[model samples]
Target: MTAPVLEMRSIVKTFPGVRALSDVSLTVAPGEVHAICGENGAGKSTLMKVLSGVHPYGSYEGEILFEGSPCAFRDIRASEAQGIVIIHQELALIPYLSIAENIFLGNEHATRGFINWNDTLRHAASLLKRVGLDEHPQTRVADIGVGKQQLVEIAKALAKRVKLLILDEPTAALNDGDSAQLLRLIGELKEQGITSIIISHKLNEIAEVADSVTILRDGRTIETLDVKAGSTTEDRIIRGMVGRDLDHRFPERTPYEGDPGAHPALEVRDWTVHHPIDQQRKVVDGVSVQVRRGEIVGIAGLMGAGRTELAMSVFGRSYGRNISGTVLKDGREIGTRTVPEAVAHGIAYVTEDRKQYGLNLIDTIGRNITLSALSKVARRGVVDEHEETRVAESYRGSMNIKAPTVFEQVGRLSGGNQQKVVLSKWIFAGPDVLILDEPTRGIDVGAKYEIYTVIDRLAAEGKAVIFISSELPELLGMCDRVYTMAAGRLTGEIPRAEATQEVLMRHMTKNTR
Candidate 1:
């Protein structure tokens, strides 16, 4: 009904080792919720950076026409001055600052550099109300969950008088209820004529709120579809994003149906773990789960369902305090109390948060790859650097770690490649059970397929793979059996044949009381 509010024509951007974007173009209607969908490293973020002045003018060859006027923003401030605000995947809030301070930090309303606390609080409070956040403006940013933090970020954007809001993976950390609330807030923003460009991997979320969709692969625009148009569907969008008919995003695996009953390789009895913060709170409430040898067992639940806590506690009691759990390896009471003891008893836990918990970013890839089970390369408390080098080099080739050399920094590598290092490190540890938490969280489709293949191989080798993921489809696809939890309690266990999204959702919400 109206001309496009923004247009990017023939956008081409390149980095040292990768062509981030090539011949990409997009048009966004006024008051439209436009979603940009692609796997990680597909250049969706690059396109947004180009538009938001993050990449800056002349860094890429492109012509951006906003409101029928060609403009080149030199920096983030320049773009923000024009009422364009971008919220990144990792929020940029100052942890020590209060909600009000964070919201009006740069855009502070002051008279001749004089303090204006009351005005700032009032402004921040109004913005918070607009974003449907009930928290007081004086609340500390650190004293909030990730979902509330997201709302605070939105409030910050609203304080900046944002016309075109850009959200990157906004709901990635949110629970189901919080995510639904955010979606509703976006819808309300649309009704108020606020244009939004959202970059996300969750296609269902995009489908719910997006008026139009754009797919990018390897920094190239494949297609942009109007939601009102007849041709828009999840399958169509998936095809455009991945360049293939993705009949199933989750690869089907045969659950443990071969033998009616089989001996579980890893078994736990009366596993009770106290909260690391609050000793009285039982984070893992007397739970028990067993994974058979050569079987993939999935843990599915909402955020804070104790799924991660359970895994961390069982895998060498790495997280919890006052942990009393009985772990039997092949029905043998070996007693895994410490991390080294767990590793010795054939248990490896590849952490969920890969960036923070898994790898040493500053260290070389070789070092991080051989961090666990160093005894293989260490003798008399001195590590054999040669053996470490050889092992790292072998994994680099076998795991297909894309880097010039094994000496390169793990942080310097791409997300997919860093994940390979994590997996390679664990697999080399020689564990009977591998606990992978959110294995493919920030990886691309191609990389995810590779990781799935690795998991498949582990299963084929008769190793118990305990997979924990927030995504139900991922659990249903990769696991022979799925165990759903709620409120730190085991709610239901579904075999592959009976596991459906609907059934899992019901079980996931089983512990409302």
Candidate 2:
């Protein structure tokens, strides 16, 4: 047997009131694709941060061995110097910079403190080619799609001459096709004898690509399964992560049978939105959608199909230019020309990009939850601190936020907890029509189930929900009626009884006149 490439022994990491990891240990074999599986807040990211030196040495109790040698890295640079590179779940690339500039941001091709543009571009071009990206090296990062941006991140890692690569939810934001391509790229990297440690909530992907799996639960290492041994199915992984057998991926709900005479809770008439940058291009072309009370309506589409544009444009013109849309709530046309008006009219939009648009990470949890509806907790233009704390604490318990207190900064919470905070803010706003864009994007299975349960309860209380997701299975599993969009047009609509993956996909791909 060959020596392990990396080993972490008796690792312990803690925050002020929370022990993130407790006596956790992991071993990765050389040239193997190893997967770290756990529920959100189960210490996967914390362990990786420790390894990558994001937490630094002397801050935790652990003995790390790399290439059979004891090493304590003081920072990320020290780890990267030994050919280890970690790409975080939230991409670290600067949006304003060009692809070449982002690839060589810190590790530049320079001489005597002067950048060599020629050398940098030349090296970036080669790296981009190696990652199968065809975009020009000088193209702005913001102009490219998320899939391409992911490739750029990999190119950046390659520039460091990485021997061991760690990817944290690399495909969380990517569509299915992009995800497949990335998994293939991982396979290719494995073929080149590069060891990889991938942390992901997608069990199927882990089952497909991982050679060995490590399961962590409540900050403790449970067991490591050898995939080659043939007992490491996705269901098996879920059982380990959640500490019980999960018979179904989705919770059961009473189906919403459509009624022609019933009035919709929310409706859009002949909505159209031109592209924000290019006014000549119509992103959403004459699209119409409606959701009845106590129903969950799903929008299914490929990336760039303008599902997000439709949602944002309807929700107070948060996106696009030249937006011409008539929004009706309870059969009455409401004027939602701005965000405050939209909220006043009982409409809420939960953005897909939580970090950017959903919550204020620097603020306390209580503050973020009260942000959308401060008027409720305010008296005479003064915030009622006691009332605010009471409301926030109520939601923290009801929504299962999992934070120590409402005083904790939202940025310190896990992805699942942050999403709960976003949901809590809007739910507190008391919107009759709620648009949830990719609500379960990067969360784990356990957290997803919790969110789904909350959505189901909301619908049971007669709140109309607009659920948009890149994952078709999620739509098929949760929606009462599914609306398919392609090329910025509403291609088809299917009832839950009639909706299947095949039907939704066909409609999603069909061209509209």
Candidate 3:
């Protein structure tokens, strides 16, 4: 290839306890869509941060040459000045601001410190049209869905006159249609000679749009394949990323065939929870479920299936109003309806939205881990700080929560590490029944393996585990029995041996009003 548009040679970066990247090299040709594929903690984000000046010039040892000229960008603005823009996996958008305002936030069009509203609206509107976002510029960003917000982020990068755009897990939050649209836009950008890099875990997307693919494993570059050279295969890429073929993404499960109608460890009878809003309808319809000890029960459905609503409502009625549910444990009903009541009764919930509802971001990892079970380490309504620290430190080590110290803020950790904290918090609650929602959602492959082992161990310990996930493969692998839901109703229940994606998807899409 001729001189590439962007090149990074021998990039090396290390944290206190983690070597994030080592000898990573990449070259992106002008107008090409190069993909960086790796399991979680594969150093993809770290490398991109170095390239985009988030790490600055000296923090990491590397040589970044843009358009065949050596470059040093001290900050993100300096990199953008040279037409390189990066959209992080976690979006950086002002929720209350109008779409136009968010798009041109830092680089607003103004005169003498006075904003030019007309020009701003016209420019933002035109950019939105290019990205196929039909929403008005005046609309608040918070009002839009995740997919629309992603398109706006892209349009914002376009406003920066991006020459090389970096998107990190851009479609992680998007639905099927939005993901396709974003990929199409990249193709269109390529035609315009704007170089791009897309980082994603979804191998199908990589196969569709990537001109070249680089695989990073354990903070090292393993291989880079030329997709146009007829050597690219999804299997090959998976091997490079995880160092083995995941011939079977789902682990095999044995059927749990004890006596039917046996006493279940956790049971919800005729459960119902209404929306908190006045005149609101029931979010969770009359539903019922029974999970036996030492069983992993799976809930399968498409988005808004009310699976999560059902779980949260049952977990001490944390989600809704007018909640009427008879929660039975060991053949006896508990006359309790509070979060602590559930926890005290040996029922713990690990939420899907870990960031917002699970973790206290401002607190240290140690504190966050012990938050749920603070009373366990207290004496006469006073917490024993030493015991709390000891318990938190143990979970950090056992959960493999990577951090410089236990005192590190939970928010500063990566998505996977933060999730470990959430799991630790709930586990400390000493729950015999654990409600897990999307337990491995944003975590990396290596971390995912560890988490899988943890869940299996929990099942082995005879805990009634409710495993909820969007990925059907995980449900098939992990759950002892699978239950499918559609539009707030239980559609079907299939034994693990008989469960299949086709069967689950059929129930997942069962339309109900």
Top candidate (lDDT): 2
lDDT of 3 by residue, 38-123 (tens): 88778899999999999899889879999989988899999999999999988999999999999999999999999999999999
In order of lDDT, best first, we have 2, 3, 1
> Candidate 1: lDDT of 317?
79
Can you write out model 1's per-residue Cα lDDT over 1-513, one digit (the tens) per residue? 799989999999987665778999999999999999876667887889899999999999989988888979999998888878999977989989999999988888799997699998888888899998898999999988888899999888888888899999898778789999999999999999999999877778877899999888877888888876656887878778778887766556655554546557888877888888889998888788988888999999988889999988887778888988688887777677778888888899988788889999999999998888788899899999999999999999988887777898887666778899999989989989999998887676667777888998899888999999987777877898898888888888898889999999899889546
TM-score per prediction, in order, is: 0.91, 0.98, 0.92
How many residue pairs collide in each prediction? 1, 0, 1
Question: Whose TM-score is greatest here?
Answer: 2
lDDT of each: 0.86, 0.94, 0.87
Better of 1 and 2 by lDDT: 2
| Model 3 bad stretches (over 4 Å) | 244-252, 277-281, 379-390, 403-409
Error of 3 at 88 (Å): 1.4
Question: How far off is residue 296 in model 3, in Å?
Answer: 1.4
Candidate 2 residue lDDT tens string, 299-324? 99999899999988888899999989
